[model samples]
Target: MASTPIIATLLKGMAMGAADVVPGVSGGTIAFITGIYERLLAALKSFTPAALLVLKREGWRPFWAYVDATFLCALFGGILLSIATLAHGIEFALAEYPLQVWGFFSGLILASTIYIGRQLHWRALVVLVAFCVGALAAIWLGSVKPVNIPINTLTIFAAGAIAICAMILPGISGSFLLLIMGVYPVIIAAVTEFNLKLLLTFMGGCVVGLLLFSHLLHWFLQRYRQPTLAFLCGVLAGSLSIVWPWKHAVVTVVDRHGETVPLVQRNLMPWDYESITGVSSAWPGVLTLFVVAVVMVFALEYGARRLQLKRAANAA
Candidate 1:
């Protein structure tokens, strides 16, 4: 039972990191499915004045006691390690059956959209509009082209910071956010090709982002919980534009080092549902896959919730 939680949390982080690497998927969805949503927020929100004072004054024991240090170290380790190892396979798979792959995530996102939207208990008009703003922003982001930008350590660090925040947010895709910021491909290439300079600079950015934004998010949860949730729900709703299964290349051009890159425009997935070709939707297997995926999400949520209860019981 003790081992159950450790395993579930790691796998959840791996799935989330894997999702983060993909273009339209949200890592936060994985976190939610895996039943860690509230705990995740609580963990991030753990930096207390007591902890800071302990750190300033003296010893390690007090700091550790003041913080839920173990969960975070384990969770972050899993997230970073999975991003390094599993991300490559996700990339390769996307290259092959981009449609099918995107389709699976499309289903995941759709289910998530329902789960999140239903959670919104809004009363104020401004908060409702803010939700729309967030969703529309995600839709716009999904349509935008990936831009090329100069790579530098400081800039990459900033990119990492910003992108990490998006990864944890339910509606936004950190990779897509990076694409909009003009560093997606560069960072991807760096990780895939093992370009040391690019990886370190980007990582430096990510570390900064993770630490800084965790604090900001923790604050948001403490104070503006309802508004933040409304905005996140809107994000989940608006992201469907990017995740739509089909896209057309607007143009192709060689990059600085002479690699062909396809610039794309959003197109309806299965372009014509009425004329659904056997070639595209032939896989009746996909239905089973979708069912399995949804079941997996529900199971993770169930198991994680039960485990938290057990952990609390043991603690008590």
Candidate 2:
């Protein structure tokens, strides 16, 4: 057969790449969004001995024999291209118009949360406990600041590994992890400005993390599926903290030059632990956006299912 599947994989990867570029979203989520999550997972799991042998001996030429090489190439190609093409636009958009962007994303995630939450097979007691656990933990973690860990190769590698997991898992955003860690803006600016040294170091860390973590997750899925699903549901729940739409910020501190820096912002997400009282919830527009997001995801899933059935029918 012609490598049509390979070409299709690249297209899927491109969609994933766009997802990866955005904060509070993930390429893995995009994989799920685009109806190729299972294939992506299978491909991740396919580092077999024969594959290794081909990679070791015949190199890139023989990789196609072992896996849908076209797909892999296409997907990565799309991801890289997305990073290159979309990153700056996303950055500029967020800078120029933050509240509106955040509002839309918050809505997207809220609907996503509901969609994923309803899929859980938790019983009454389980649902109550899981929601409480998930919500409480999210509230708790939202208040925690990034402990200033020393920057080193090992730490970078570990950070990369851990960060990649968020990107892979639905509802968890790798960018959110980095933001919580106080590195999200730093790294994005680095990439945006094309700082070679910083970019390479970050990539080195991410690669090491991905290789080790993907296998660990695979093992977890195989052996502890129920608990894993529960935990993931919790994670999806917890992530809502990062995207809450509104909060109060004070105009207290001045810059070092005493130029009287006026207005600034702080978050209730962090300040709630300090006995600060503030109400933060989605408003009407945000809620509408959330509903739209749910509809979008459902529509995408429906389309994907129809395509899959058609393809299967043709094969038969």
Candidate 3:
């Protein structure tokens, strides 16, 4: 099999990183959209006792090839680069242009949900039930109020483990999970300040959690492709709760930086937004951005298909 171009994988990883910076977006969703989801899962799931044995017996080169280390390096390198560069920019956009930014993400997620749902055998009762169950689970999870967990060694470690699991799941947001655990600020601060001790501890948890969760996801996807995809589709559909274009914060919390940040927000209609907030709803601009985002997803898929066909033709 032809290895995916390094540049292409790097670009996809950057896109994933950008999505992950936001509280509502999932890098896994981007990976799925970009056609590397299975490869990523396989690579991550390869880090096992068997791979260690292969390394001990064969060598570093064989183990590296077996685990696809080059691909992982390129992809993760891009993710890290993007997060380092774009974290502040994304934060500014979210704060300054909440409506338009969220509107765009809402469209992306909605289109992704449709795209994934179409691949499932919707006629199957099990698939339908799984979709509904997944949707409800997402909604319930999103609606839960954030908790104020005291920042400690154990909590930070646990937060990393839990959040990294969500990070790799389509429609789940690891940053939001951190928010729920009241550690989002800490993680962000650690990243910004380059706190090596905390960063290392967090990454340790991420590695452990990722390995464990990737195995489970790979197993489920291998055995029950249709139902598993249906569930993911439903989760994507339900994730609209977080990305809704119009919302007002109902609960706020003060961060360690002493800045008041929103903890809970209620979705609102455009007209209701104007009436309540006494500011222009700016619905037209938001709606236009949303439509563009929807079109962009479809366009990306079309281009990907064309690329695959071109590659096949060249190989032939």
Candidate 4:
């Protein structure tokens, strides 16, 4: 972790930011795949009251180093930059090429699930049970129908708090949860319009949620490494349903912009999709993207492994 370059961390952060923008994809999955999940969790977990004491006694430089401020700043800067630049582009892609976009993410998560699963000691009963439980939970979450609630300060804050917690989990998506809570459009509007008051409220909730949840996750990872990994793998596995390429909206809702969008969708087979929706399935293109995404994941894994081995040899 210490030897990782700043640029690499920034790129990883950018990847996470991109994933977070997608409804079914998770930024936590990106962090885990890039081998920085534990480090990221530890950094977030360090912002307790004790950190203030360190700042008071040891001064700025020591405090900064102690909390790994440089790493945080670089990573978060990348995330903010990515979100600012890519949000509209991704929205356009999702609107115009929904099948391809969702197919790519579905493949990414499928490959990630396999990669993470291989790291766990699956022979253990506890790990197996954890995996099953995680899978079931993720499936249930994916099946939840979106609700339209009145948007207010308190609701936005609550949505942020709940969504942020899921955002940091490998299988769950914060954006999807926001959709389920009926605040996703409002949050997107706030970002695009630079609504400072709403953005600040949402961010405050995110801060509180991150601080509270990080400790529990850190403890579980430390104490039950294999089971935790297994559970995360299961989560990634179950999340595939949410990102499946072929889906038709079963329920729709109108947002503030008066745009009618999917509130609930049901997955469909490639063949059945055309029949049911009367839209071309474009199965070939979607399949091609899925294959490309799968290959990209394995390629990334291979490259990361080679880099690790080279670094280990140099250290030795």
Off by over 4 Å in 4: none
Per-residue alpha-carbon lDDT of candidate 1 for residues 39-111, written as tens digits (9 for 90 to 100) = 7766665675767888788778767655656666667778877878976888788878776777677667767
The lDDT for every candidate, in the order shown, is 0.73, 0.64, 0.88, 0.87
Q: What does the lDDT read for residue 50 in candidate 1? A: 63
- Candidate 1 scores a C-alpha RMSD against the true structure in Å of 3.5
Clashes of 4: 0
Off by over 4 Å in 2: 1-15, 18-23, 48-50, 54-62, 65-67, 117-119, 124-138, 147-155, 249-288
* Each model's total of backbone clashes: 2, 3, 0, 0
CA RMSD of each candidate after superposition: 3.5, 5.4, 1.4, 1.4
**Stretches of candidate 3 exceeding 4 Å from the true structure:** none
- Model 1 misplaced stretches (Cα beyond 4 Å): 1-4, 45-52, 56-58, 122-127, 271-288, 305-316
Return whichever of 1 and 2 wins on TM-score: 1
TM-score of 4: 0.96
Candidates in descending lDDT order: 3, 4, 1, 2
Q: Ten residues in a row with the worst lDDT in model 4?
A: 1-10
Q: Model 3 over residues 230-254: C-alpha lDDT tens digits?
A: 9998899889987788888888888
Against the true structure, candidate 1 has what lDDT?
Answer: 0.73
